[model samples]
Target: MTSNPPIPMRPIRTAQSRFPWHHFSMRFSSTPRGARLARRLAGERLDAWGVPYGSDTHDTVTLIVAELSANAVSHGLVPGRDFRLRLSAEGTTLRVEVTDTRGEKVPALVEPSDNLDGGGEGGRGLLLVAALADRWGWYPCADGPGKTVWAVCSASVLAAPSP
Candidate 1:
């Protein structure tokens, strides 16, 4: 009797492999109310994605969204245009991106000392984003006259156990 060659075993797939990634995108008016709505919705979405509402991951992402959205509304606003918020989770990272029509008004990370010395009440948005996000930056939108500010939170923060 001839013995047939044994078949190779396939690697087992994890839960992440089954779902791959999650994404959310929405356009909001370039207004403070709109920014507030974006932040609330972002937290809700994160909670749905297994990052509990009060978890570090959820709070960090939502705060990033709030800052970026506020910047878009405050600095990147163009009359009759709206800002866009996009969130995506893949692998062990969660990325938050906010896009606005005014590409020329790029955000800068002002030194905290400079703002404090000047008695300024603002200009600290990017500073907070840099502190909370593992990485953050901006790029011109490919399909439109705008810029997208993005921040990423890695598993180091995202892996925190739910309380």
Candidate 2:
């Protein structure tokens, strides 16, 4: 009996595999203006990636960028340090990440019953992020002294019929 060589098992590619294009990143000052610019540029980048303005994905991502960027400015700001905004699209998922130099002020998820509105000054941004994003979390910056907050929103999924 002849022994046959084992067949190679190739990795399967799903709908998420055939990526056409998806990546964006930029640095901004740790200020309110920088936060606003982050949101604007993120929208433009999504438009360039075929997500278009006024689309659900575009709006959701833009909001996420705004909230995270604002958090970086308000809670994570360190004088003279700049924050970074990174956008990535994989499959039907769009990820928004904002990094700042203040890792000590890590974000916390507030309960619906929490006094987000009663506090007055602020504290509702992450709540908005939680409501809109499919998933979100944060981690310490890999190469520096800070943290990167990230959120993911589902995109292009509802725009088309699934097989």
Top-lDDT structure, candidate number: 1
Instruction: Tell me the whole-model lDDT of each prediction, alpha carbons only.
Output: 0.84, 0.79
Clashing residue pairs, backbone N/CA/C < 3 A, model 1: none
* Residue 34 error, candidate 1, Å: 0.2
What tens digits encode model 1's per-residue C-alpha lDDT throughout 55-124?
A: 6777889999999999999999999999999999777788999999998987899875555555667878
**Positional deviation of 79 in candidate 1, in angstroms?**
1.1
Give lDDT: candidate 2, residue 92.
64
Q: Residue 89 deviation, candidate 1, in Å? A: 0.5
Candidate 2 per-residue lDDT, tens place, 11-130, comes to 323555523437778999988899999999898777666666886667888998999999999999899999999998766677889999988887998654555476555767899998
